[model samples]
Target: MIRTEFPEALYLLILIPFFFIIHYIYIKKKKARLNNLVDKELIKTIAPEISYGKLWTKFTLLNLAYAFIVIAISNPQIGTAIEKSERNGTDLMVCLDISNSMLAEDIKPNRISRAKQSLNNLINQLNNDRIGIIIFAGSAYVQLPITNDYSAAKTFIDVIDPSMISNQGTAIGEALEIANESFGEKNKNKSKSIILISDGEDNEEEAVSIAKK
Candidate 1:
C-alpha cells in the first residue's frame, strides 16, 4: 500500500493533457506555415535530420519526466506503523488552599500566584505519573481527576483561584478526605501521596489525623 504526504500535488497532473493539446496545435501551425513559405524539397534539403515522430516522442518523454518529478515531491511512503507507551511512575494528589488568607501581601505578588507557579514547576518535572488536583476553601472539591495527561493538569492549575469556592474559609480536613476518597479505599499503590499547599491558617484540627490515615 502506497500513500503520498501531499495529496494536493496530484492536482498538477490535470494540466498534462492540456499541455499536450496545446503543443499539438502549435506544431501543426508551425508545419503549415513552413510548407506555405518554403518549398518541400528545399525544407528537406535544409533540415534532413527533422522527424515528426521523434519530435512527438521527445515531447511525451518531457511530460512524463515532469509527472515523475511531481510524484517525487509528494514524498510517497509504503507500509504501516506501530507505537507503544509505558507508565512506571507514582500517583499524587495536590491539595491547594484557596482561602482568603492566600491573598496575603507578605509574599511578592500575593500568595496564590506563587503557589500556582510552584505547582506548575513541580508538574513539569513529573513523567508517566497520574496526578490529580483538589482545590479547597470552606469546602473541598476535585478540580482535576487522576490522569497521566500533565498538560491538562497545568491548564486547570493556571485558572485556580479563591473565587471558585463561594464559601471562603479553610477546611483542611475535608480537603484531605476528598483526596483520600479520590485515591480510592482499596488502591494498593504504595507510591501514592498528597501534596498540601496552604498558609498555615485552618479551623480543622483533624487535618493531620486524616492525612495519617
Candidate 2:
C-alpha cells in the first residue's frame, strides 16, 4: 500500500507559513533601510523592475517548489502491487478469562474490558502469525480455531462476554487444555505460544501442570 510510515511528519505544513512570515518581515526591514539611505525617486529609478506584486509571485512559486521538495524528501512513493511469496510463522493461541471476577470494576471499565483492549493492541502488532482464541469459565470451548484469519479471531474475541457461557467460575485448566487441543494437525515444528489474559484471582493447580506440558 502507498502508506506513509511517518504521517506525523506532514505537520511540517505548519512551518511553511512561518517561513513565509519571516521572509516577509526580512524583506520589509530591508526595504525600510533602503528608503532611509536614498530618495524615493532615486530608489524607484534604481529598481523600477522590482514590483512588490512580482516579488510576491516569485515568493509564492518558491514556496510551492519548497513544498514539492519537502514531499519528495518525505519519500512520496507510488504503491506497486507486489506478489509476495508466502512465509510461514508461529502458531499463537490466546486464552482469555471469562469468569465473574473478570467483570469486577477493579480496572477502569472492568478487568475483562481492559484485557480486551490490550488484546486488540497486540493483534495490531502481528504480521504473519497464525492465531487462535479460547475462552473458559466453568467449561471450555473453542472460541476460535487456529487459522491465518486474523479478522475472524478479532470478531470472536469481540463477542466474548459473561453471558456467552452458562457457568461463572474460572476453569483455567480447561482453557489451557482446549488451547493445547487446538494445535492438533498443525505443523509440529512451528513455534507455538499461548497468552492467558486473566486477573489471577482464581486458578486451579491443574493449570500449571497443563502449562508445563
Candidate 3:
C-alpha cells in the first residue's frame, strides 16, 4: 500500500554522479594551484588543514543529504482510500395509508399496526434492493427517501400514527404520484415498483393515470 506522491522526484538521483565529477575537477584544480605555489612534497607541510580525503568526505555527505531530500520531496504515503461499489437491485416505494379509518380494530390490534408490521417484515426480506416510504391520509408526503438503510426505515415506520396528519382521507392518487416521483428520474430505465397499503377508502385527490407512466 506504500506509494510515493511524486515519483518524478526520484530523477534527482541521477545528479549524484555529476556531483562526484565536479568534486574531482575542483580537487584537481586545487592541487594544480598548490603545485604552482609550492613543491608537491612541501604542499602538505604548508597547508596542514587542507586534506583532499576530507573534501571527498564532505562532498559525499552533501550528496547523501541531497538524495535524502529528493526522497522526502517524493512524499511517500501508506494505505489507500477504499472505493465503494454500487449495490444492484430493484427499487420499491411503499405507499402506506395512515388515514383515521386505518386504525380500525378489524385486523388484530388495529389495521395500521398490522400494515406497519407487514412493512417491517418486507424490509427484513429485502436484500440489496432500495426502499422508500410515503404516508398518505388526505394528502401525500415522503416519510423516508429512497435508501438501502433498512434500520433507519424501521425507525421511521415504527413511530407512524394516524394522528400525524389533520386531513383524514385516503389520497391514493396523490400517494401514487409522490411514490412515482420518489423513484427518481435516473431510475426510469431500471426496475422500479410501488406497494400501496390502504383500507380501500380513497377520495382520489388526483388521477391515478400517472401511475401507468
Candidate 4:
C-alpha cells in the first residue's frame, strides 16, 4: 500500500487555513475602503457574479492539490520488494586457559573465572559465526568441537573451571597443535580464526608458529 514516508510533513496543512484567513481579511479591508469611496450598490451591480466564498474554495482546492503533489514526489512505493538477506560467517575457535595459576585472584574473582565471564560476553556479541571451544590447563582438550551452535559454545565455556583439567599446567603449544589438527581436516578455505584468551602466563610460542602455517 502507498504510504507517506514523511508523515510529519502533513502538518503543513495547518498553514493553508491561515493563508486563506489572511487573504480574506485583506479582501474585506479592500472592499470596505472601496465602499467608502464609491457606491456599494454600484460595485455590487458591476460584479454581481463574484463570490468570495467561491474564491476561498478555489484557494483551498489549490493548496490540497499542492499537498498531494508534494506527497507523490516523496515517491511512495506500494508492496515494494525489500529484500532481506543473510551472510555466511567465519569459523572461530575460543581457546581459554584453565591452569592453576588462573585461580590466583590477580584479576576480579580469579583469572579463570574472569576468562569464562569474558568468553560469555564475547559469545553474546557473535551473530552467524561458527565457533569451537578449546580448554587447556597442563595439557589440551577440545571441550566443544567447531559448530554454529552459539548456545552450546556458551554452555561449554561456562562449565570450564580449574578442576576440568586433571594435571594443571599451562601447555599452550599442545592446545594449538590439537586445534590445528582438528581444523585441518575441515574445509581450510573458510576464514578460520582462533582467539586465545589467557593471561599468557604459561603458554608457549609453538601456538603462533602452528597458526602461521
Candidate 5:
C-alpha cells in the first residue's frame, strides 16, 4: 500500500492557483505601466521576447515544478505486502532434575542421559513454539532462555551434569520458581506450561505450592 510520510506537506498545493493569479496580475500591471510610458506597438517591437503565450507557458511549467516539489516533500512510500500467520503453540518450560541421583544407572544409560534424550526428542517435535530449560540440583539455573532455537536447546541439554551446580540436593521448588520467572511478563497472555522431568526426588515440599502460584 502507498502512504505519505508527511501528509501535511500536501497542504502547499493550495498555493498553486495563487501563484498563477499573482503572476497574471503582475503581468497586467507591467503592461499597463508600459502602455502609459510608450505605445503598445513600440513596446512589442522593443521587447519581442515578452509575449503573453511565453509568460503563460513559463507560468504553467513553474506551477507544475512547484506541485511536484510539494508532492516530493510529502515523501510517498510503498509498503511490501505481509502475510500474517497464527501461532498455535504454547510456551513450554522443561524443568529437568540434574542432581547426583540422576546419574544413577536405573534408566538405561543413566537418568540424566535419558532425560536429555527425551528432551531432545520433544524439541524435535515442536513447531512455532518457544521452549526453555531449567536445570536444578541444590539450586536452579536457566540452561536456555525461552526461544524457538531447538538446536541451541539440544546443545545445552547435552552439557547437563551434576557438577554444574556446586550444591548437592534436589531443590525442585527453586527450579519451578526459576521456570516461572523465565516465562517473563511479555508472554503472560500466551498459554504457558512447565514439564518437570525428575525421579520424584524433590526434597523441597514447596515445589508444588510454587507451581500453583
Candidate 6:
C-alpha cells in the first residue's frame, strides 16, 4: 500500500500550471518588446540558437522535475515486509459463552450480544496477530480454526447463539479444552492465550484444572 506522509503538499501541484501561464505571459511580453526593438526576421537571424520550441520544451522539463521534487517532499511510502522484525504478539483464542443464560437482559440487551460486539471490537483493534473463536455451552466446539483471518472470525462470531449448541449448560472446562485443541500443535511454542468471556458461571468444577494445563 502506497501512503503519503505529507498529503497536503500535493496542493503544490496547482502551482505548476500557474508557473506555466506566467512563463507564457513573460515570453509573450519579451517577444513584443523584441519586435518593437528590431524586425522579427532580423531578431531570429541575430539569435538563431534561441528556438521558441526548444525554450518551451526546456521549461516543460524543468516544471516536470519540480513536480517530481514536490512529490518526493510529500514522502510517499510503500508497505514493507515485516519478516525481519521479531514476532512479539500472542495468538489469541476467544472462548465465548453462548449458553441460554447469556440471553438474559441483565447486561443490557443480553450477555451474548454484548460479548459478540466486544469481540468484534477486539478483532478491529488487532494487527497481524492470529485469532480464532470457540463457542461453548454444555459442550464446546471451534467455530473458527486458529488463523490470521480476522474477517472470518467476526463472521463466525456474528452467527453465534444458544441454538448452535444443543447442550444446555455452561461447561467452562470443556470449552477451555476445546479452545486449547483449536490452537493446534504448530503454535504451541509461540506466545498464546485463551480469552474466556463468560458471566462467571461455571457448572464444571474442572475449569480451573483445565486452565492450569
Identify the candidate with maximal TM-score.
4
Q: Candidate 3 residues 136-204, lDDT tens each? A: 898889999999999999999999998788897878998899999888778577789899998876655
lDDT of each prediction vs. the true structure? 0.89, 0.82, 0.89, 0.78, 0.89, 0.87
What is the per-residue lDDT of model 1 for residues 82-141, given as tens digits with 9 covering 90 to 100? 658676678899999998889897997889999999988999999877899999988999
Compute each candidate's TM-score over C-alphas: 0.57, 0.57, 0.57, 0.59, 0.58, 0.58
Candidate 1 accuracy as TM-score: 0.57
Per-residue lDDT tens digits of candidate 5, residues 72-174? 9999999986899897788999999888888899888998999899999999899899999999888888989999998998899888888898888878899
Off by over 4 Å in 2: 1-87, 201-203
Off by over 4 Å in 1: 1-87, 185-187
lDDT of 4 by residue, 33-146 (tens): 888987978877997876777877888788889778767656566776678888667777777787777888988898888888887887888778778888888888899998
Displacement of residue 168 (Cα, Å) in model 4 is 2.7
lDDT (Cα) of model 3: 0.89
Per-residue alpha-carbon lDDT of candidate 6 for residues 16-59, written as tens digits (9 for 90 to 100): 99999999998999888988999989987998886788889999
Q: What is the Å distance of residue 49 in model 6 from its true position?
A: 55
- Model 6 poorest ten-residue lDDT run: 80-89
**What is the lDDT, from 0 to 100, of the residue 187 in candidate 3?**
58
Worst 10 residues of 4 by lDDT: 198-207
Clashes of each: 0, 0, 0, 1, 0, 0
Stretches off by above 4 angstroms in model 6 are 1-86
Q: Point out the higher-scoring one by TM-score: 1 or 4.
A: 4
